[model samples]
Target: MVKKIEVEGYNALIECLKENNTGTVFVHFSGSLDENGVNWCPDCVKADPVIARNVDKAPEDSIFIHCHVGPKAYWKDQNNDFRQDPKFYLRCVPTLLRIGSPQRLQEDQCCSDDLVQMMLEETEENVTPRY
Candidate 1:
């Protein structure tokens, strides 16, 4: 079974990553939620179901981290930690990335079931080597 973790903010995400860095790790960065449990980003809202459905494509021991990147104002700031952090350097919400690898899907890409499954099932041998 895949291990799933939900974290809010950059600090929480960093802490979670420190503890669970090994194995097949996937990080999903999305917008923060309100009291109603609804995310501020429409794209994130749309991509959630697609990602959830494709989770089974990953290995059983894989780790899935769902990171909420705070409110719209926070995410729009140029100094947002998620964007500045070299490990992520996120350009948009609803980003699905394979840790320790170059594989990633952003924005509308995350809403595509086909792309999400492809990323989840991709292996190290399938990754294109970086020059």
Candidate 2:
């Protein structure tokens, strides 16, 4: 089953992490929403608690994604990796799954039905399982 958090906007990503599920979420920031005023990056701000709770868990792969804002990069590997938007960040569940924490999904405006369909085109190249 897909587990998720209902948040208002992409800016609200951090708040979703603060919810009760208690797991690491990776963020990808690559757009015009200004992060300068937010003090700490939303992804970093939210990761503190999740990291604290996951002390003894699998440390290597449990990180959530939070990329820098503004013009993004094309992160495709020569290994046929599924490429996501420069701004596309994710909270891949396997790490959480390995540590026995449920995956925490946050609703994004870009996560519209259209985007969902468009994104699925990468399924064959999926390095990780998505909901």
Candidate 3:
């Protein structure tokens, strides 16, 4: 089974990655939820369920990290840590990336069930290492 972790903001995400950097680590970045538990980004709302349904496709023992970027205001800030961070440099919400690899799906791609499943099920041999 895949192990999952939930984190809010860039700091917590960094911390989580530090400890769970091994194996197949899938990091999902999405907008923060409101009091009603709904994401601020419409794309994220659509992608959430699709990603959840396909989570089981990930390799066993894989670590999946769901990270809430921040409120709308924070995310809109040009200097937000997520945007400034070299490793991430995220430009949009609902981004899914495999840690230590170049595999990633952004924006509308995250809502595609087939793409999400393919990403999750991708084996190490299929991933080309980053330089």
Index of the highest-lDDT prediction: 3
Stretches of model 1 off by over 4 angstroms after superposition: 129-131
Return the lDDT, model 1, position 8.
Answer: 96
Task: Write the residue-wise lDDT of candidate 1 on 11-88 in tens digits.
Answer: 999999999988889999999998898999999999998998898898889999999999999999989999998778
lDDT of 2 by residue, 1-131 (tens): 12323232334644444553344333323222344633133443353334323333322323333333321232223221122322233332111111122223233422333332233222223335444
Residue 104 in model 3: shift from native, Å? 0.8
Highest TM-score among the candidates is held by which one?
3
Tell me the tens digit of each residue's lDDT in model 3 across 30-121: 99999898899999999988998999899999999999999999999999999998788789998999988888899999999999999999
Give the CA lDDT, 0 to 100, for residue 68 in model 3: 98
- What are the Cα lDDT values of the candidates? 0.91, 0.31, 0.93
Model 3 CA deviation exceeding 4 Å by range? none
* Winner on TM-score (1 vs 3): 3
Candidate 2 ranges beyond 4 A from true positions: 1-46, 52-56, 59-104, 107-128
Arranged by TM-score, best first: 3, 1, 2
Scored against the true structure, residue 49 in model 3 reaches a CA lDDT of 87
Q: Rank all candidate structures by their lDDT, best first, as comma-separated numbers.
A: 3, 1, 2
